[model samples]
Every structure is written in C-alpha cells, then in structure tokens.
Target: MIRIVLIGLWICAVALGTLFFTVKSHMPASGDAGEKASYLGGIDYATTDVFSVPIMTDGSVAGYIIAQLIYTVDIKMKARITVPLEYFVKDEIFRQFYGSYSDTKQVEKVDFERVRKSAIDGINRHFPEPVVRDLLVEQFTFMPSSEIREMNMKSIGKRLSEH
Candidate 1:
C-alpha cells in the first residue's frame, strides 16, 4: 500500500509539472506578441451578479431576461471612483434590455454589440475620463412567462408526489 501511494504521488507530480511547462511554453513572450495580448497587468475586471428584467407587453409580464455582465477597468483609475463599478454595469444592462423591448416590441432578437457600446458609453458619461474600458456579457438568457409557468407547475407536481 505504501509503495502504491508513493507511485501515485509521483505520477501526480509529474503530470502537474508537465502541465505547467506546457502552459508556460505556449504563453506569449514579453516582446511583439506581448503588445497584442489584451490582458496586460494594468486592467482589472468587475463582474456583476445575475440581473433579471421582466419584459412587459400589453400591460402584462411577457417574459424575463437574465443577464450577467463583466466590465474591465483600469486598476489604477478604479480606486479614484467612489461608487462600485458593478452598479453602473447592472443599470446599463437593464436599460439596454428595457429599451430594446420598447423599440422592437419583443426580446427575441438582441444586438450584443450595441449593448456593449451603450454600456461603456453610459458609464463613461458620468466621469470626466473614461473609466470603463469595455463590457463583457458572460450570460444572457430569455424565458417566456408561459415556459416559466410550466416549469413551476412541473416542480409543484414533483413536490406533491414526493410528499
């Protein structure tokens, strides 16, 4: 048993070392390639919790849009801002979805590029210098109210069967 355990540990160490070296070899060198690398050290990302917006049509809740956003900011400049960055991102996402619903009368189609542009522009408007570098949409999903009701009904049925 002891010998087997020692062999397993050695194998794990070798695997880890191989993985590390492989990743290191593929990493961009600090030269011309470094210039093209988007994630240099000076930038930091702020991720927002999931935001949900109820789409309204004809004075009733038509569906729901769920989104998660990430915003990149300059690390040095982030400290100067008083309010948290996530708040602005969440507000912008909500506005984008809400505004789109109003303009198109449905949330089936989304212009992701427009959302990103508006988010960066909207947040930057408050500050003299542009603080938000870019906006990233990690998750964006839509579910109709009827599907939600169906899901709820199924869940209720399952719970009742369990009891």
Candidate 2:
C-alpha cells in the first residue's frame, strides 16, 4: 500500500512539472515574433477607437465620432476596418466602436476621403511626418449620448485618482 502511494505521488509530480514546462515554453516572449508584429511601422495587429468632432451649423459642435477598429492579417496587406458605432450625439460620442456591428466592410470612398483628410491633419499636428498608408473604416453605427457622458465620468474619476 505504501509503495503504491509513493508511486502515485511521483507520477503526479512528473505530470505537474511537464505541464508547467510545456506552458512556459509556449509562452510568448517580449522579443519574440508576436511582439515584433505589434510594433508600429511594422506589420502588426492593433485595434483602437478614434473620435471625430463634426461642427454643426449653429456654432454648436456635435460629435460624429467613429470607433475605428482595424486588423492586419498579413504584412503590407490591406487591413479591414470594422465600424461598429455611428451615431450623432448632441455633444460627445462614446461607445465601443467594434464588435457591436454584424457587418464588416471597408468604409466608402467618399466617407473615407472626408475622414482621411481630417485624420491626416490631426496626425500631422502631432507627428512630423505621416506614418499611415491609408485610413479605412470597417463598420459604423451610432452611440448614445449617455454613453459619452459615462466615459467622461470615467475619465474624470481616473484623473482624480491619479492625484
């Protein structure tokens, strides 16, 4: 009975060690291929939300903020932008811009032309030279005003916490 118990314990230890090693070996390192793919100016995948403010005729600004999400499947490949949010709010726009829509397609050329120039202008202000080859919006929808307010609240909370 004692011998059997000892053998069981030994088996468990070996199994655990093997499992740990396997998981560690498969883990991605900072300098690995996956990390390399995430760097800017390289062929990497990134998804981020962008906000645009549209000026209304009455001197009051309304947000035509679009949540721009993109994914690069291959290097130097034309990635798809999925617009998941497109809504006109009185003041601000806040919502998850991706994964909320069923459609996944590129933004129309006319729409792209309008937004791209604005985006380029915005980027140029911060960056000395433009880095983006093209800008595309995959999916677009509307976000509620309440959502934008909530996001503002959250930002305020964060700032308060930092101090």
Q: TM-scores, in order shown?
A: 0.71, 0.31
Judge candidate 2 at residue 12 and give its lDDT. Answer: 100
Per-residue alpha-carbon lDDT of candidate 2 for residues 97-138, written as tens digits (9 for 90 to 100):
222223222212125465554554443343333334444556
What is the clash count for each candidate, in the order shown? 0, 10
Model 1: lDDT of residue 38: 53
What C-alpha lDDT does candidate 1 achieve relative to the native structure? 0.82
lDDT of candidates 1 onward, in order: 0.82, 0.46
Give candidate 2's total backbone clashes: 10
Instruction: TM-score for candidate 1, please give it.
Output: 0.71
Best by lDDT: 1
| Cα-based RMSD of candidate 2 | 13.7
